[model samples]
Target: MSERPDISTPEHIRQLVDAFYGKVRVDPMLGGIFNGVIQDRWPEHLAKMYTFWGTVLIGEQSYQGAPFRPHKDLPVQQEHFDRWLVLFRSTVGGSFQGPVAELALTNAERMAAMFMERIGFYRDHPERFIQ
Candidate 1:
C-alpha cells in the first residue's frame, strides 16, 4: 500500500469531505441517517462541507452557518456518534497525515463530543451545558 498524502490545502479538505461523505452514503450504520437528512441534495451538502472544513482547517472564513443546528432532531445515540468517529478516523487516516490531519481528527473528536453533549448524552452536568 502507498502512503497517504498530507492534508494541507483547500483541495485536500475538499477531497477529504468528498471521500468521507461517499463512505457515509454507503455506510450501513450512518447511511440511513445521512441519506434521510441530505436526500437528493448531496451536491449542495458536499459544497457546504467543503466550505465548512476549509474554513475550519484553514482561516478561510468562507463558510457561514451553524454546524450543529441541523443535527438537533436526529435520533442519534452514543453508538452512532462512536461509529461516526470510527469512520471519520478511518477516512482521515487513510487519506492524509501531518499537523493538518491531526487537527482534523482533533476537531472531529471535539465535534462528536459536543454533538453528544448537545443532544443530551451528557446530561449529568446540565448547569455546565448551554441552553
Candidate 2:
C-alpha cells in the first residue's frame, strides 16, 4: 500500500491560484474589470494569495498585504461581488480535489461573506473604510 502524499503545500496553493486566475481572467464579468487594474501586479497578487492560503492552511505568515485597498476603486457593485463568488467557487471546485477543495471552499465562502459585509459597510459608511 502506498501512503498519500501531502498536497496542501505553498506550491499547491500556487497551482490553485493559477488555476483560479485562469478562470477569472477569462470571466466575462471579472475579466475586463480587473485586467488593466491588476495586470502589472498580478505576480505580487498571486504571491499574496499564496501566502493567504498558506497562512490559513499551513500556519504561515508570508502575507502582509492590504487586500481591500485595491478593490476599493474598482467598478464593483454587489452583483459583481456575487458573480465573483460564484466564479471563484466554480474555479476551486473544478481545479481541486478532496479535502483540499473542501477547505478551500470553506475559506472562500468565509472570505466572500467578509468581503460582502465590508462592501456593505463601505457603502453605508465610507469614512470607516478610508485609509
Candidate 3:
C-alpha cells in the first residue's frame, strides 16, 4: 500500500465518496435499500455526497439540505449502520490520513448515531413524520 494522504481537496472528497458508495452499491445488506431508493439517481446522490462531505470536512457551504430526512424512513437498523461504518472506515483508512480522515470517521459515527436515534424516534411516533 502507498502512503495515505490527508483529505484536503474536492478531488479527495470525490475519491472517498465515490469509492465508499461504490462499495455500498454492491454490499448485500445495504445495496438493496440504497439502490432501491436511489435507482437511476446514483449520479445525483454522489454529487450531493461530494458536496456534503466537502462542507463537513472542508468548511465549504455547498451542501444545503436535510441529510437525515431522506434516510429517516429507510428500513435500516443498528446492523446496517454498523456495516456502513465498517465500509466507510475501510474506504477512508485505505486512502486517507491526518486530521481530515479522522474528522470524516468521527463525523460518520456521529451521523450514524444521530440517524439511528432519529429513525427510532420516528418509528415510535410515525405521526411526527407526516409531511
lDDT of 2 by residue, 9-55 (tens): 77777777788787788889888887768878888777788888887
Question: How many clashing residue pairs are found in candidate 1?
Answer: 0
List the candidate numbers ranked by lDDT, top first. Answer: 3, 1, 2
Worst 10 residues of 2 by lDDT: 1-10
What is each predicted model's overall lDDT from 0 to 1?
0.86, 0.74, 0.96
Cα displacement (Å) at residue 7, model 3: 0.4
The whole-model C-alpha lDDT of candidate 1 against the native structure comes to 0.86
Which pairs clash in model 2? Answer: none
Tell me how far candidate 3 lies from the true structure as C-alpha RMSD in angstroms: 1.1
Candidate ordering by TM-score (highest first): 3, 1, 2
User: TM-score: which is higher, 1 or 2?
Assistant: 1
Each candidate's clash count: 0, 0, 0
Model 1 residue 62 distance off true place after TM-score fit, in angstroms: 0.8
Candidate 1 — worst ten consecutive residues by lDDT sum? Answer: 122-131
For candidate 3, write residues 1-131 as lDDT tens digits.
Answer: 57899999999999999999999999999999999999999999999999999999998889989998899889999999999999999999999999999999999999999999999999999998867
